[model samples]
Target chain A: MAEKAKILIIGAGKCGRALVELFSKIEKITIIGVVDFNQDAPGIKLAKTLNIPTAVDYREFMNKAGLNCIFNSTGKAQIEEELMLSKPAGVEVIGGCSVNLIQELIKEREKVEQQLKGLAQRRNNVVGNIDAGSTPIIPKMEPPDFNKQVKKDEDFWGKDKLIESIIQNSAVATFVINSQHKVLYWNVACEELTGTKAKDLLGTSGHWKAFYSHQRPCVADIVIDNSFVDLDKFYKVYRGSTLIPNGLHAEDWYSKLGGKDRYIVFDAAPIYDTEGKLIAAIETLQDITERKKAEDELKKAYTRLKEMQNQVIQAEKLNTIGQLASGVAHEVRNPLGIILQGVNYLENKIPAKEGDVFETLTMLKDSVKRADKIINTLLDFSRFTNLDLRPEDINSILESSLSLVRIKFESSNIDIIPEIKKDVPKVLADRNKLEQVFVNIFLNAIQAMPEGGNITIRSYGKKLEGIENGTSRREEGYFMIGEKVVVVEIEDTGVGIPEENLKKVFEPFFTTKGLTGGVGLGLSVTKNIIHMHRGIIYAESRFGHGAKVTVILKIAE
Target chain B: MDRKRILVIDDEENFTKLIKWNLEKTGKYEIRVENSGLLGFSATKEFKPHLILLDILMPDMDGSEVAFQLKCDEDTKDIPIVFLTAVAKKEEVEANSGVIGGHPFIAKPVELEQLIDVIERNAY
Candidate 1:
């Protein structure tokens, strides 16, 4: 080899940079320098890194000793002319079409090299599989050559198949959609979750069919469209995922999925190409129906526990009030008895005639009676001890209560309607106490309807299903579910209790009635008696639409 | 029928005074009043009353102890004793047929006619 040729490139653009890279590997040519007007050109920066000289002007390398060749890739005719005239004697200048031709050949060689690397990788994989005791199925075909470009394309497509299979066999429900919103991949897990085979949904834009009755964008479609604002319109609970960038996680309850209601949590993210352009979106789904049911059950249990705690507090409060009332009643009654005796003695001394003297004595006597009545009622409310529990007919008790209030009903123009069921089961309750309970309830019903409304007394045997007790004071597990019980419902078309006061009716001294209402201990005593029998009593009212009170007691075995 | 003698025992002096005034006004009975159970037990021996109206809850000595002492004496053992109390409810006395523990009981604050009816029925 006569002396190696020292070449200088006139441009540092893409083509010039490619030529520099290609020539740097040639054995017969030495890169003398790279020249471009812009100091930041790609080819100049690369040449500097390789230890080759770089210049802003081609004339700086023109007189360099033994510089024998010049390649002008700038595509500017003025630069080519200057390079040709100023080149050293016996040096050659190549420009225009010749440089363009060389660049094409260099790109072609790069493509061939990439194909050969892919072939080598495929060969190594096959040998590795053979060593792992797996039979290798080699394709029977002609040997690979540069001209067989389709074979190299087929090899790349084989890698795409591997990705497709991996997604198809995954345990999580997954689907993919192209930029046009067409379904591209609906995997086996998606097929099972939606109860729709993959073939019907593969090429169709029917992903919404799985979750909604009408067509709407799923989370994956929203991600592809970059429409984050639309998430609220579709999902009730959703938030951005912390684990994945540009991904969304959401939970929703679908009324009908695979013929049953299902709660699902899903995550969707956009897939981007190497150029950072959004190409498709992938979404995964998980069925959370069982978990949602368990959560609901836990919440209900917590509410029941709170109610039981309140009941215990209420019982203790009632016991304290009872003891206090008992003591006070004993002290007060003695004085009341003495006053009545004094009044009686005065009545005998006075003449047996109607006069101011006689009226004054009678008024004094009546006042003592009133005070004694209040004391008696208070004592009744606090006394929860003596219960003569026996298996007794609830129907007969209801009838007796109705009879006791019949005079009030007739005087007030109220109508009594008894819908007493025959063959009703007997309840384990004290007869007199149960009678008192019904009488108090009936009296309340009578008082509520001052203008005379219908009082419906209905009694029947029922199996408790846990919903019979509507009061929040109900203790959990007090009555076993499905146990036989006697249900007595007394409904009145009276001035219904205000909604806010419904729960407080059973509380002592909680009365809407004024002083004439007998101290508000009637229902309170009634509730104590019913609770002593291990029964449940609650009231429901619609303010002006009248009220209904239900009482449930265990049926005698 | 001769006027029957009645003895009233109670811790409240006003109550015993009121009972004596009311019961004597009827004219069918003469009344003796004692403010303490111990004094009432002593009064029963001298008063020789046909009936004794005893109050159950007294501070110094209750009616039960007074009745036990009176019954142990041969002179007052045969006299009919009635318990008039404020502690027992009227409904409870009526449910027990106006008698409890072998003695007739009357809830206090009794009207004159009802008190007269009970005294006449139980008096010897």
Candidate 2:
């Protein structure tokens, strides 16, 4: 149904003979004639064999009927110019320089035609042999089945599209790659996670760009490479490689991705052909960053709960001790009353001339005084049940307490540094009890530095940020966020409490100053008083360095 | 001047008797020791003491309750009472000094001189 192209060759040289041989097999074109100055040219001889007419003068065949194209392969500039002028209107004259191009195109066409004819003949021979009731000759070589190969390629792309759809609709980010590490499938989740489109990544080995700034193999590439070497060099915390049912699995924390660090898991498996040959590899990704954050928060809350449980036990123990001490103190005071009156009577009856007898009576009275003081201290600890809370200036109370200890400081050769911020917020506190707390702390600081040292008191008002809970020294649920509070810090440069004894400092009857005639109820009662005022007190100290006590109280609205 | 008559109300018999002998030895006063609150209340009417020394903690009735009873009585209501108590420390008594709770108090284990000094200053 197609018209043939009429063509002529002006040169009868080797290139011309080759072009004739190449174009003779093309069905769309027919060679009309060949011409050269030599009658014995190789192309002229080849044209005779092919049953084509030959001419010595190319101009003779220039305007020949059915001639639609002319090839000037003479290699003479004069002949090409002459052919260019004399060529007919309907004919296209290709010049001498294009002879090589024409030969190359004709050679390619000849090779394709021969292959097609060979396949056609083999099919006909096989059919003929079948009709003759004979076995067909088994050829030494066989041509490839074009239809079967085309169908196989189509089926592969179809499976690829099916896999791509599955990944595209997945909730987790995923991607797939070929054996050469080329990206074959990058899904919608992958697009959102890596901020890179599938269209940009498909058919390219750029999987590392999503999780790394530099060019390196990802976990999928490692599986394909099957080289487990230097995996830690690539990932932040790789759990090594493990074999799953259909793949190799790897998990790690990747911190170098486009700006966000993420925890990722990957599964990669080698895809094989029907012959069990390796063809490609596929991998999937999952991001667990938010899950990790929730886990850390849970751990912190559980630790706080345990600390609160311990503090409740301690508070209950101290409460029991308090109840017992109160009962015993009241009962013992009456008997102590009788002994003191009897001692007074005896002292009056006995004269100073009685020497050791009167002196011994005085000793008995002194012993009774010491016993009474211990009992009174126990009562003080138990009797602090009610608090008279009022809006009082904490800074003023601190100043008054400091004045009460000024004489002790003068006698002890200690310097007092007061850094009180003016206009400190008033706190809801019992003024008498809070002043007693400060007085006890100041006296302890003086006693700690018997040689000579410095005592620093700092008072200021601030908005509460974070408050620690679950300690006996601080009452939980008493402080809230953004509540205005007054903070007082009493730091002393003296013989600091040792590290082992820091937590026991606020416990009743726990003291480091044994030689000093104290019942060890100073800090214990101070802690109780501050708790009554709905405040917190905690101590910090280094063994050789000084001790610091911080007290926090809510400011009155 | 007539020696001042003093009445001591306390649960401890030995304690009150010792105080009675000690004050009488001074030759400055006459004293009566009542070991129970009900008996002490009746003794104030019969003795008509110039000054009363009341113990805070007592059997059958507390000293504060007995003090309220004496304050209501016509014969003993005018007598200035001094509390002899061991419930408070000696330092606490000296810190408040002189009169507290509308009456004078002497902390227990009081010296003879301190006891007589409070009686002379407060007793009429």
Candidate 3:
């Protein structure tokens, strides 16, 4: 019932023997005939036992047989002699030779695949996602079967045979890592990929030990480091002199193996036992050199697109802010002028009733002062746009900010304990901007503890590192201390910002108070200022446990 | 506890004048005004007012710098100074005022009733 190719052979010597054995193994190709001039040809007995047609003469076999294709495995110097003799007799003769027909099958498959890939590449590549050439209209579905997949997956991967089968059959390296990230199981393909045999890698924490520094045995100058950057989604594709980090099951990473740079894509899935415990990640790896190249191209395009989007967003923000600023100036300036005029007007005119005249004047004066303060704040907002970066002492900045709010702190009976470091290294930043950042953070701290609690401000060099967007690769501290940095942490024993509202603090105009909602510009401005100085700011708080904000800045060269 | 005398120091002339007029209208205290920290320091010695209302942002040295100087000097250290600012950020006001020992702050565009109440509560 199945289709098979009927292949006929014209010689039964060493060539015929090779033909009979190789062609018989392939289920798709059936050897119908093996012919030899000698009765005792090496393959003749074997072919006869297998019930295949045997001929002492090629002409007799050609006269009797009907076949799709013929191979003349017999060695020949002049193929022209064989082709003329065979073609005139109405037989198709392959040029007196046999090569792997499997190669032809492979070439045809490759041709089809190449055409498809070209079409896919042209159809707008958004890697790891649906391509644009996909049909716009979706086919109708019956219903959801969430349980069908998650449940049946157990049957697909049987218990005992799971690890062995997945490892042996996978084209990519398969591995199992334990709790301490030690290699538990290393498959044969891992040997093929990393070139270190399974026996060599087993029980040796080589990946954790020397894999980072030692030059790759195969590909020179490839990054030997294979470690993970901790994040919620820690998957990323790597290339360019980088050794694919072990343990992480990201589809693939770049490594130099076999004397040439190659992309080895592998995924490691963590395996767990009952009671919902995290055991180990089962990893699978593959060589996706060409696929990686295409992916990298797509990633580059995506990054460019993201940058363009950020530029557009920032530009829009600036435009809107400019309009708001001008409107505020217009809206407040006219009233300010009116108040000025009114004060001048009141100075000359005497009201008939002297009792309330002084109170009226006082009200007008206070209102005018209030107007002036608003104008000043607006001006300050605009001027901060042009940051005047300089080497600034954070100690002085903190001291100055505290002084501004000292009166209010005392009146409210709040105890302030400043643990500021003596001789704190000066950071390269705008002094005014730094003060503003501290002031904003300090204000939030004070607001948290309304009844007045202990507030601590601590400063040190290299205290914090890897604060998102703030820490650079050139720095370390665990605050991880790879790149040296200076850090200041401010803490307050007040009601902590809620978990839900913590991230919202950095969004402009987002505030908790209904009518008292500040423009919510404080934290946003603080974040922007720190970013401007190439510094990082991070806040940690537990509900009712208070909040701590850490600012990490590089000590300027 | 006769009518307490209150001294108001600020760079804004209209603000000082307004306080002097309003505080005196209460008929509970005598009011005197100075338009600068330097002038205010001088007035403290001459007038010997019971209470001093200070403005933080002023020419010829700011209010906190003035307060720090006052705290250091023997003559004006005894007198209580209250800071009046239009600044909305409590942290800035706290940092500026907290460093100078104990002090009080009130935001401007301040309600006339709240001003009178604060003045009465803190008066000598």
Candidate 4:
């Protein structure tokens, strides 16, 4: 064999580094030295690690034995001309552009070599798998060479185009990102979902732009990072997928997708190469905006249905109690009347001058009257009498109710602030019953604030909009959307009802007042009267703050 | 003033008796008691009181039927009938100015003063 050819690379840059690595691997050539102005240049470092001679000055190696060739990679003409003039007689200097061409040819050859190695390995895997499985009978055919077989395999798999086509034509939005977090594939479905073209997104790390207003890692990026523990910090709802190992799923509401609000679900999984190395991550997206809206609507409808069911049960219970109350009233009131009349007779026959006799009879009469009052309240609570409905102004009714309780308010040191709106529409309601409702509410407010507070009564006409829930009121189609209604709100700055008791305030026999204050039927009776008028009544309170009772009645046509 | 005559018609015997005693003790009226609506109607013609204090919800006959019969008659139609019953609510009675069904009404367990006021207003 001839003597080995000694090569010298100049510039110690990327091109020079490629030349050094390539010549070092050749069997018939040896890299004699590397030269660069920068001591820390990549080629100089690599050449030093390979135990080749390196220097900041090329003249140090100029006279070395058998240094026959010099590759100039710095792209400086003055350095090339100087090297050409001072080089030994047998040595030749290749310029920067020519070195570049030689580097390209070498790189191309290495790439082809890597491809052939990979194809040979893949072919072995295929043949090995086929041998391990049960054989299938086939017609005799000629065996192809390795190159032909590799070509056939490439055509059969159509790896890149087939995967891209599958993703592009899929109805579900999908995208893939490599380990460097660069978007490798952004399919047509993804384009439609995000309103971003593939040409602008491919090879970029801007997949987050489709779902978020700011820069952030998407699910696929997180998977590629293998940072699932920090998923909660980025997503409100996220969980590990049950189907795929090392897979994750998350849901979020994006406000700016396609210029519309959308609820999106992301399913991301780590894609591994044949050697079980995580090479990339794939993420599939689903637009669940309509499904989420429907779910919310279904939730509202279920709540309404539950409220109506409770109302029907309450009405039935009240009806049963009413029947029982009427029966008891008829049976018990007659005897009470007899006792009261007897006490009156005894008072008349035995004069007041008798020792404690008139007092005793008065006490007896008082007890009888109290009993009758309770029975009357029970009767009122259970009564379902036809409303003597008439078109009447709500302001006037509120004023009348306030007037009736004015003396109580003053005595209790309570301030009455009437914010009644003028020209309020008339509501078809029984005047007496509605007056009773307001009076009961005012009395409750007064009782609530025995230490003196403010009772604000506000009345206004409004157009009904959406149905309200969880207000101790039933939406039973009594009030239509856009219907005119008179709303009366009575707010009291007193000891607010506790949150737990807010819902029970309208239930029969549920009262915060002690035994002497009331029989727990005041709000129940009030709710009944309002319902009879086809109105809604509900109470709201923040504990330790205050209580507000609102009554809504439809305006008469 | 030949004390105004009043008749008490109620199914409760003790209630009617006490009412009669209480009204007579007032010395402004003479009282008669009947236990049933049917008997009360017959006694109305016999006693010919100035006012009829009728109890509704009586078992034998309802007070409204008794009132209907009295109004249908020639002699008793002129007499005023005041309903003293447990069926009417006091608030409703007061709200309607103590009158219901074209006649005066007083809820039962009534105080003596209110009862007297209603009776005097309705009686001739």
Candidate 5:
């Protein structure tokens, strides 16, 4: 406001327009000449209306126009040229529109001009505008802790102040946890690394019990089978689990806090105390909820693709087998037809005589029967067989099984005392297979009691130990379990299975009766049948006392 | 009426022997057993058998081809051919309604009476 003269302006963009606006509104200062290459410039016209002279050529105005201070509104690109032209000629180009807008631009230019006067350095103040509530900021200096004197400082507040100094002063996030893995120290950097503030995370257990059922093989995917895995190794969780399956590195673990699903990524490192004790683990939990979701989606897509590939392969195999069936059908049918024709002719020739013709006819018929059996078996195996389950009475099956063993039982003098439980619950089973199982178990029981012993069959929910389905084992759990299942028990008074061998009896190809030339398919088929019905069978044995087998079935009601 | 003659066409020697044994021993007709389709096609013209029992599956020319060639010829066209295949299901035999100019088939490993009955029915 003190020194007034002609101020030259250049460039007619937003910056140029702003300068014209601000300077035009000012009263004393005269914008003597507005110059730009664009002859039809709006600012130039405004300058014309203001009664100031306008020129495209700076050289033309240099002689005619008198200026005290120059404001170069041209731009950064043209600033150096403008300054070189004006500054050597003893002009102050002070006010101009710039990138550093608001009041900082004005102060910065002042500092630049002061440097020419050999003024002392001036720091950039926290500036906006004074009326706009701007304030200058400057921090107080503290004495440096150079000597080792503070190392043994006795004051708790002094130590706290020291630790707080390190936390705020250093760029890294840090924490000092106790031996119990309780978080004691949390820094500002830690809060920034995780969106969680220090207050939310402090004094809480940093050891998270993670439960993920997905087990998808990507990401920093760790499977926690037990309550905990040895957290001895540190993993860099570049990617984490999310709602949407990530194709690669998609970890899907469950959260124990109300069994919610939380997606997080982390960089885990072992934490040690000042005394060098392996106390806790320090980890940064990055809220990768969005990234985890994207990852989970990708992982799910990969799994579905793999499943589709396997299905296609299986379908192709079935197609090839279907093609082969044609040739097989013709080959089988031809021989079958010939046998039929031969059998018909022999029946006509023999006329029921006990001779070569009759014997040959009978053999021919039997051969055809055997061939039919093979074809039927093949058809059954190839066809998808659904269960035709019904509520089959177990005692009826047992009785039929005993009828099959009746002749042998009497001949072998293996006495059987039937102590079958009356009013046993009927099980949902395929009648044929259940009968097969009954015959097998009955025969086994009869064989075990070769020298005549009594068999006790009981149906009760009794104690079974150390098994997941042993609901009846616990005192509080047994009575409530009757609503879930009914147990069938069969105990034989014979030389039982050995302590070491009880578990193997139900497995296929495991039979101790080697002398009887057992094919060992019975128990395996029995076990398969029982499993198909969604039941469980287990055995308890003592070498001399005898073996007791218990089967548990879900009650129909 | 002239006695019937049957030409048994089979690749296997033992099968031919057994058929020849059973048929020729009965003295019911003049029987000739040819071991191959090539030999049987020629024998059909020379033997001039009233009926031909042709085995369908063979190494060289199959029975279907021999039947085809026979029905194509003027001299052997008059003879009735019955395909005797080891692998002719009921549907397969039923499907081959008229294999060679209304000629029928009796499935193979044929019994003594059935073969005799087919011969008797087709006998000229």
Candidate 6:
């Protein structure tokens, strides 16, 4: 009997439990104890059932009698280092990954020894039959290249055991096929990934069962066939194919294997014999589903970041325009003031009896007045700060603002229609500034309906879902999903805004009315004031029909 | 018994001339114009005006600086100053009886009647 090796296991985890199961079955090794900080670990519970001793610390067994090995399964390098530094002489420390490797090697050695014993027994039976003058017919089972001189491929793969083990243990799924599409090499990793055993697939041409339900040419089959034109007929819609050194690479989405879709990348290369004859083709597959998912998410995030960047740039441009307008308005007003006074002086000095002279002065005076109005509007649009906020009724503000323009609208033969929803919520806003915003919009509606049409003022309060698509501009500056808001829609039945001009309606100095007194600042100033109130205002129109201007405001808490 | 004497100081020549002509046209006052603040300050001593109409933005010295200097001087300290500016809001000027900053400040391009009303209210 061999000398029994006494060993201790450290860190009772899954790995430790596995080691215990393997070491317990071995005849030459005896487990002294299993140690773990967690007393209730799965491995510790399993060791207890086997009557093995358990401890919270393994240092107590450092100098134990007859201990030959200490297996450190902790996976922590520091703990393994400390154990190695303190191990007693004559004891071996098999730690970390090598512990599992040693366990596998021991099982392999046992299997090989059993096979040798069976071969020896068969040889004895054959010799006895020969003595009786009886020849038994046995199938020839020999490794390839038994009669031929060492071929290049046989010398490289068959003779080299290290390369054979490397191919068997490769992490990426790989398989080799002959010209007949027969699988010659199916790695262990490939079996684990496809849930097919290598023993069943080897020497068989049914390798397509791993990826597809029906018979189809895999990448390795195409390499063996060497029919490049058939690639498009078989895999017509691959992502792309690249020519690598002595290989072709392609990636595509595969779903025939009854599971979640997988984006697999595969490379195929032809293996040639020493005389340059094609012997086999090998194909390697790598699952890139997670990496592709992360890349798509990053692309979406980058797109959102770019959109925010554009909005910031637009806001900066608006700010610059506001500053420039303020400077220009101030400079123009002084000269305009002087011109107005001069015109007034001339009007007084010149006699009214001189027809053209007095009329021309009146026209000049009117032009100066018009210029002054434009400058004032420009100044108003730029100076949107120091807002006075208070909780005020939207209905009352609409009513008062309408009253300011009611007389003008009535004189132009345009009917005024007020549709105020009762019990509307109050909004936090500057009462005077909000009034100015309503007044400007009302005046615009009135101007749009110059040919005697009805001006409808609709007011209501409700919770608005996020702004609808197609009108993204209204929600760009300010709005949250599921916001409580009060809406005032001022619709006019007149020549509506053109589709092309609808986007430009809120822009400064963009007006459809030519020669008419549409300074174009009415909607622009209204937008500025509403923006200051943290509200939204937008216009919807049909070219030949009428236009509707909607204003949305947040409800005060 | 004598007419009200006024001194108008502004950088705009045409504007001051129009104000002088408009005020003198009323036949209730005699007005003198000066384009520069320093020149206008000296004219105050020689003209001995009852009231001063000053422009806020001037070349050499602004209206506030001139007002500070006049207030410091013994002879000119009693003279009331009205600011004529383009920056003042028309409605604000009208709401406060045409007076701004405790003194009358009229928005420029004022109507003749409105300007006379502001002058009468502050000149005394």
Top-DockQ structure, candidate number: 4
Tens digit per residue, CA lDDT, model 4, A1-557? 56677878888988888888888887778788999999899999899999998999999888999887788999899999799779988686777555765566566557656765766666677677679884543323222233344333222223445355656666668888888887888888889888888898777888777777789889898888888777777887897753346778898888878777899988898976544667788898878799789888999999989978987988787888788788878888888888888877777777454578877887898898788888888898566778999899989888898899899999999998889889899999898889999999998998889799998889999887777654334445787878788899999998999988988898888876677677788889998898888788888899878899999998998
Clashing pairs for predicted structure model 4, backbone only: none
Q: Could you tell me which 10 consecutive residues in candidate 2 chain A have the lowest summed lDDT? A: A237-246
- Candidate 3's C-alpha runs over 4 A off are A1-315, A347-355, A384-390, A463-484, A531-534, A554-557, B1-124
Q: Whose lDDT is greatest here?
A: 4
Error of 3 at B107 (Å): 21
Quote the positional error of residue B119 for candidate 4 in Å: 3.2
* DockQ of candidate 6 (2 decimals): 0.27
Q: Please report, as a residue range, the 10-residue window in candidate 3 chain A with the lowest summed lDDT.
A: A215-224
Q: What is the clash count of model 1? A: 0
- Give residue B68's lDDT in candidate 3 (0 to 100): 82
- Runs in model 6 lying further than 4 Å from the true structure: A1-318, A385-392, A407-414, A425-428, A446-454, A463-485, A493-504, A509-519, A540-546, A554-557, B73-78, B95-99
Residue B42's lDDT in candidate 3 = 76
Model 1 lDDT per residue over A337-389, tens place = 78888888788777775899999988998898888777777767565457777
Backbone clash numbers for all candidates listed: 0, 0, 41, 0, 23, 0
Candidate 5 CAPRI grade = incorrect
DockQ of each: 0.45, 0.22, 0.04, 0.56, 0.12, 0.27
Residue-by-residue lDDT tens digits, candidate 5, A1-557:
24445566765555555566657766656676777788778777677777767788765555544565555666564664556554535454544322224133334434545552332122223333334576644423222222322332222113345444544433444444443445555667555544346576466644232222333211222321111232322333333211112211222333442234555444334433344334444333334456668777989999889867855864564455445444554467556655565456446556576888788777877787656544432332233345668876766766776788777767766665666667767767776666667667767877787787766666543333344543323343433432555576678788888977775686545678894546454675676567666777677888888777776665554
TM-score of 2: 0.52
Model 4 chain A is weakest, by summed lDDT over 10 consecutive residues, at A138-147
lDDT per residue as tens, model 2, B1-124: 6899999998888778778878898889999999988898888889998888888877788889889999997877898889987655565567568567777888765666788899888888
Model 4 / residue A255 / CA error / Å: 12
Chain B TM-scores, listed for every candidate in order, come to: 0.95, 0.94, 0.82, 0.97, 0.87, 0.92
Off by over 4 Å in 2: A1-322, A346-365, A385-400, A403-413, A422-432, A463-485, A498-503, A513-517, A553-557, B68-80, B88-124
Give the per-residue lDDT digits (tens) of candidate 3, residues A150-194: 232233233335344545555456665554454556677676766
Model 3 error, position A139 (Å): 48
Tens-digit lDDT track of model 6 for A101-179? 5455555555655654665566568778888789953524322322353444434345535445756876767888876
Over B45-64, each residue of candidate 6 has an lDDT whose tens digit, in order, gives: 89998889898878798888
Instruction: Report the lDDT tens digits of candidate 3 across residue range B1-124.
Output: 4788888887767656666665566678788888888888777878887778887777797888877887887887887777766443333444454323357776454444556666766766
